[model samples]
Target: MAADKPTAEAVAEQLARLREDYQARLPAELAALTALAAGFGGAESDRARLDELHHRLHKLAGSGGTFGFTALSARTRTLEQQSKQWLAGSLDEVEAQAWQSLAAEVAALGETLNKVSPPQAPAILSARDSLTSDETVQIWLVEDDASLAEQLRRQLESFGYTVRHFMQIGDAEAAAHTQRPDMLIMDILFPQQGENATEVLALRPILRALGCPLLFMSSCDDFESRARVARLGAAGYFLKPLDVPRLVNRMTQILDQLRAPPQRVLIVDDDVALAAHYRLVLLAAGMEAEALHEPQAIIETVAAFRPELVLMDLHMPNYSGPELAGVIRQHERWASLPIVYLSAETDLDQQIEAMGRGADDFLTKPISDAQLVAAVRARVDRARQLDAQITRDSLTGLLKHASIKEALEITVTQARRHGKPVTVAMLDIDHFKSVNDTYGHAAGDVVISSVAMLLRQCLRMSDIIGRYGGEEFVAVLPECAGGDAQMLMEDIRRRFAAIAFSYSGQAFSCTLSAGLASTAQYPEFSGAELLVVADEALYAAKRGGRNQIRTASPHPLQEADRP
Candidate 1:
């Protein structure tokens, strides 16, 4: 059976249920703690029993405020601190009195638990819904020049963007009120609407209303104009005559960031209710989150989930968070995985000690849901950026050669096991060296990045793309037949030919050749072998003519029928 999709309403419902379960079990938990405290005969006697009592109080302290039992958590935190001090053999007069009062304090927990209402689950935006918007990207183009607007609109539409061209700022503003755009592309200068009326003044209200990202294009390259655009929070400012490819590249980047994959987080806390709460909060914020109660399963879970960050409790039964973090770091693969301790422990010395062990940071428990989401998001974003710098091509942000090969191997293996077809395409720019010789290396870079952007735009989200090397790329398309892949590559090739590049006031164009191999024909071939076959076919294409696709299959496969 398919699992129900995670949603804010669903998470809130689960949170309510969890709160009820926690509340039902609270009295019995307090009773058990009271009995444990009663049996305690000073810190030195029955150390195991003393430790058990401390652990129970520690859990209550950590979870109470999370479920809206703030007073209970606060009081229990004090008791837990005293118990820890006792365990350390710091039996001063104050410590002794604190230990003696444990039983009475634990008994008072039941009363405190009933006095406060649990906080309602926060309103969280569904991450999947936001990331996977069904509508095509809508762009508003406010360019008065008819030729420029038509050219720009056509270019954007070829990349699958819906471009709405308005000759005047007033028209774009009126259209914006009718239907909001995902992005706004406008000229810095406009015809005067009134005294001192500029495009900036006209756009101020619209920008504030839509809050969509803005890109400005203009003939004016002066400081004041640039400063005004910056003040309006323009994402990019392009100088005229605009390089359409560069503008498209900027738009691709903005869209890529908007549609980046959800950040994965692993929540490790022995307290089930608290863990669930954290998971729901993060899920609502559009991050992939899972809660693991068994500290023993940390390594296995970490490996399986491949979480960007680990949020763990410092104290757990049998296994501490720091200890688990150490076990995780033992594996060279996970050495740099961010581990954060989220505990109720406020002692600076203990937080420092925990961080020194293996954790990257420490987050005190009782953190609000908003703060938790913000902190986790910030850390995950930075971690992903750093990871990308290592694993992705700096020029195109596609997977590096080794990374793409690894991806291809993994995908091929999975596809073959399921008796499915996977196609690999080796793509290379035609006469790329000549481009470098005529244009500067910087222009060559722009051409390469332009192709990279087109690949991302033209291919399916499931397809894996990589920079095999300079001016060379690889695309792994799972379940795609050779014919279908050929058609797709042909479309990309045609689009690439249409894109115009300018260098030193001179305009030129370039094309690419692609070779494809499908698993249906080459079932025995490994990923590397399949890649080699595709490369041979690519060479064949280049030999035949500069711009075309050639397949490695002995007999060409027909395109699979589509609905």
Candidate 2:
């Protein structure tokens, strides 16, 4: 046969598809291989089975090498040789066991190889062509017309615009609770089909609450409809049958105008002279700074300015540094607020105590300007890590339920404050209890730990993964909408299902189901409400079937949204 020729794009797509397919089949393949090897007999019947396995290994080695899966090829080649030896009667019982062990090892390597294959750069490049780093524009299409909604979806997808669509304002409000898209394209004359007008009007407060860039789209651009959209805080108005190209350009311009550099930092100290001194140091370091003398007003000042970092003195009479730290920690909203003690508490014990009491770091009074700046930078970085760990699960290193809730709250607050997008997902292992019962708790541990590790490897570091007790895990993805979060979780679900766990000479496989909900569809709900909705979706996943992800009902009542 002539040497097969495939374009790089074709090969890459084929490889990507193969990786996806192989991940789906990997668990079963490994189980079969493990059982065959472990149960191998010393007669001709066993030889026939061994020959079949050898042929499979040979085929995998050859094809894997051709497909640039070098590690898979190498491991398969080793297995192929071992199988040959076992079949040739040149292998003793020890050699047979070794061959079986090698087969299992090769199977594991094959799973890894599937993930390591480089994703198709061309596909990413093509996707990127539709989006620009400079653009921050997004659109929401609220239409009962499914055709129009889908048409707009395709058009926006082609333009690389983030788009969300809903038939009812209730659904839209629910999505906006977590995600605040850049714009809203609404149908003015919604055919009030058994939906309450008050409920519909309630969506306006939710949209306004999100503070997102908004636009209205309606077939009937009547004065009443325009007036309603205006009251909803819309920025632009457009009639249905929108000019896609013109809309894109206009959105790009609006987003460009909104982009700006980072904000300034201000440190308030009761010592007036010291405050001014710190301000000058911060200014020299190229940051905007202000000094305030009143310790009591730090909270109000910070709330207004929203500075990224704060430094406080420990020795203040009325508001001690530790007390101030406690206040900041209690703010539930800014619990992760970085507070560094800048007092002259030189005692080693005091420094440790301050840190233990929520102070990110402590510096002796009369600190150097250089030391101040460096300490601020270092503590800010550490605060981020600690924030992550506090929310993450200890056993699986995923997010804990509390952390997931915190993240969702932050996302909702941010969207209501700055119009950013957010997504929440709940994951649960399928029939997990059965695994524990059949394989023993130790094997169950392996499965849970393995799944957690795989989830960490699969998701971006920016994404938050948390254990929600039992076999359930939750992920909070900032800057992502429901569709994208669902896809990512599904990929994780599939990869997790394909992984095999071996213990006590037996091998088993596992699967997961996930529920995805985003703020894009429901903009008015709180973070707590969004989590309930996501959890409800998880229940749907469990009900529909295991090993799948389900999107929650867009208009689920608040009380009914929870499990």
Candidate 3:
């Protein structure tokens, strides 16, 4: 018992020392946080300072709880949550009460630490480490803020990116024009206040002529700025004082999304075995395909398969390849679908005649498996590319005007049949041309892309969103209401506003104006009718301060455009 008493005292003494050590260290960290908070206000609020505060609070949240300062830990945890909200929200959205409460908690926790005589410290467990590393991907960072630029360059490179830092949009544009990078990470605000980066990029045409996905960061958090970024088609947006790891994670996601899906082909040949062999050849090369052995089933198979290129045989019991090609072209939908002849025929005149009969190209008999796979892959890939040109908007992957209209019709038809509600939203970026005129078309594209990405990200997967031509978008929310859709759009509005657009050395943001209408309100209204209602409501939003949403009257405003 005497030996046990000494051991107990020693353990208690060690615990007391730990508690005292943590309490001593805790004040300095809290002081730093308070100092950071004091600097985080007005237009000059440093995003970097806010992030530093966040990082410190996160450390304290874990460390305080571990060091047996339960009161300090609990208060710090509450403050951490409030800090995160302020970090994510715009300056206007930051709640004063929350901020004051956090300050009070910090003061209270400090007093708690001075008075409490706590129990002995147990074993301390460390936090799990951050992601080990990632494959190096090529990226470009364009910013004029020397300090922030250098900070970002080092951090992004440390995350396994081969990063090139540039100070101006012009320089980055020139470099990109010469040779496109894998991705672009840029500041929306630049040194040139008059420059619109997207407009300049649009005119240049060389950079992003194919597709170079982008991310944007800025100090400004406003609706107009985010709207501009959305129009420009940025895949990701960050409010500055960047969370380096989170930004890296977003970059990773953008790259992954850009990765191509497996190539698909639809093979139509009468010989079952031969078609199967060709299918195997293509499949081995990572192509997705379906084979049809019956000429009579060509239409049904083609419709179901939806292949990029059709593999047609010249000689079949039911129909010649040219005849089948003619039949395929007769259908309006399949007119542009590529039809390639794979046959035994060798006559040049006959091949020319087949080509004249709507077949795109001919491949003669005794072709090697390598040749077949390569040929099909090339043709299919090219065809899909061409199809995108026709069906999708060049910058934003959303459907073109006509395509979206057709999609709306289809969605409406389905909704009507099932007695389901459908909500239509017409959204336009506020003060968009000023963004293009001031920042250039390049910046405008970023704004458009940003909005498109947000629409895709925030909406339900079942919802269909489309680029409705020039700074405007249309979305079909099946089984959603005007109020529900309004709430969703407001969410997008707030999120968009929170994204800062850093261009040159300045930070900017954009906002959205949305008008919504739903079928549940007027069961008699068709899809087109709903659109007219939504359009009217949209105009109302434009009138009632362009950053807001307006729900249209349930009654029909005008006739909907029919397909």
Estimated TM-score per prediction? 0.68, 0.38, 0.54
Candidate 1 lDDT for residue 273: 95
Compared with the true structure, model 1 gives a TM-score of 0.68
lDDT of each model, Cα atoms only? Answer: 0.79, 0.65, 0.72
In model 3, where is the ten-residue run with the lowest total lDDT?
124-133
**Alpha carbon RMSD to native, model 3:** 19.2
lDDT per residue as tens, model 2, 421-514 = 7778878889999999998887776667666655554555456677878887777777788668777777777666655455555656788888
Error of 1 at 477 (Å): 1.3
Off by over 4 Å in 3: 1-264, 555-563
Model 2 reaches what TM-score against the true structure?
0.38
lDDT per residue (tens digit) for residues 319-368 in model 3: 78889899899999989888888877666777888989998998888799
Q: Largest TM-score belongs to which candidate?
A: 1
lDDT tens string, model 1, 1-563?
54567776698889889988998888778866765665443434346556877898999998887787887898789879877877787333323334545654665555455346433222221221132212357798988778988988877776667788988777876655435677989886665543111345554586546767889888878898788778777799999999888898899989888666667789998899999999989867767688999877888888766788999888888888888888999999999999988877656777778888888987877899999999999999899899999899999999999999999999999889878899999999999999999998989999999889888887766689999999999999987885788888988999888888899889999999998998988998899999998998888888887698888865544321100
Error in Å for residue 234 of model 1: 2.4
Of the two candidates 1 and 3, the one with more favorable TM-score, higher being better, is 1
Candidate 2: worst 10 consecutive residues by lDDT? Answer: 128-137
RMSD over all Cα atoms, model 1:
18.1
